[model samples]
Target: MSRPAGPAPLLRRILQRGACAALVSGLLLVRQGRRDACSGAAPLNAISHWLWPESALRQCGLSARYTLVGAIIHWGASCFWSAIYEGHRQAGAPPPRARPPSRRPPAPASEVPSHDLVNALALSAIAAWVDLVLVPPRLSPGFERHLSDASLCRVYLAFGIGLAWGGARGRRAHRLPPGTRQLHVES
Candidate 1:
């Protein structure tokens, strides 16, 4: 009997997720910077201000501090989403219903389509849409106030691309030696 392969190593998975989040968020920041710059505005300053208004941070008396705080918030959010996606992958595909008691082999890991890039892209898109349209206004007041629709679209696209790329990279890393099982056990 074959057991489904275990998920990738915890540290590796975390790194992959973190890297994806960083890339996506960094690119989004750059995109926002470019757009704001074209309009003769200081984009970084704008991001810092948007994240924490001057009134709110007035006591702190440091705009740079607010910018750092905003960066942390944005990247933390990206890592959070990446963790969610990785959790789903680790759980593997759901078992089919109503199987008779038998010694049938477990399905091969490759047969499970959950780790594929297309699925990642689809999941990212849905997650982005839901987060942007459904969750923000209810949970995060003024979250969308500083962002335009085009900027949001770019953000989503970057996230999807980053997710797919990270998943593909992790999958490649997790491929076992031809005769090995899971991590080290031999068949």
Candidate 2:
């Protein structure tokens, strides 16, 4: 048996993990919201309630405007983290050993897997559904509330941190061999 070449395996694993993470996160948020509601806590808001689904967004002090703001924050964070990871990988090793001098170079190590675009979009949709469709129906009338702006900002920060951490891990795992000369040979 022989290992396959290129990034097919790596891509598959990333997609699998991304999907699993999104599913697990969604389920946990739903469960927490239900538990909090049952305990008489305020219900979380539709757009800004990832960490504590049971708590009302109103209590957190966020406005409806923060929803769009948070989305923008998330997108920027993802891009930033992805770039950092790719940069790190590029810096880690020598160029691949074998190559046509005129050929284009491979992508940087920190680059997000192309498959991740789909995963990111799917995860975003899942998050929206959890916040909007699922949480609202389960919330009691008294639970509907908005989060504080500060609290929403904090959540965005945490989300950014998570993305950075995941990007770093991916970059570390996918390091291509350094030294272009070492990678290929003229037969």
Candidate 3:
């Protein structure tokens, strides 16, 4: 039998990336909510200084200027990373679940992670480095302005989990029957 094509058609893959980005973006927002609970969503407002860069005070109230802009920025960033993750799969990091079943019984989830999860985490780490380290303070994610480093870690953790979960869900939804299992990924 012919091997199932990895991923999906070009158009579908693009859509999948968008879907993944949405999921990741939603997770990020959820994490942001925790910050909101502590600070009045000011973290969202802090992200953009287009209007009050010089002002010491930034107000966040779910207005178009604050939360909306932050959400959009977060979504776009998610999309960028999702595209890269999908591109890597298309470029031949064996599609997840395409690997042959392990002869030994599948290990507990905690013990083993599919390659896709590792990849997702790596991408997430890269994103954290870029957003927090490489990017200038002016360009840094606004949450940092209001959150402690511990809180930031939680946000990134949410991001990685979202990315992996989204990727896996997207893969399963598009999975075809009797696809080739020739691809071997060391779990």
Identify the leading candidate in terms of TM-score.
3
lDDT of 2 by residue, 120-173 (tens): 444444443444457655432222233333433333333333443354455545
Q: Candidate 3: where is the Cα deviation over 4 Å?
A: 1-40, 50-57, 94-113, 175-187
- Model 1 scores a C-alpha lDDT of 0.55
Residue-level lDDT of model 3, residues 1-187, one tens digit each, is 4445545454455555545655554555446656544544566666555444633125645677666666666666676777777787678855446567557853333331567678777887888899889987777766676667776676766666666766555565534343642343444
Clashing pairs in 3: none
Model 3 / residue 102 / CA error / Å: 14
Model-by-model lDDT, in order? 0.55, 0.40, 0.62
The TM-score measured for candidate 3 stands at 0.66
Candidate 2 positional error at 96, Å: 22
Those runs of model 1 whose alpha carbons end farther than 4 Å from true positions after fitting are 1-8, 36-63, 93-115, 136-143, 172-187
Q: Count clashing residue pairs in model 1.
A: 0
lDDT of 2 at 90: 48
lDDT winner: 3
Give, for candidate 2, the lowest lDDT window spanning 10 residues.
39-48
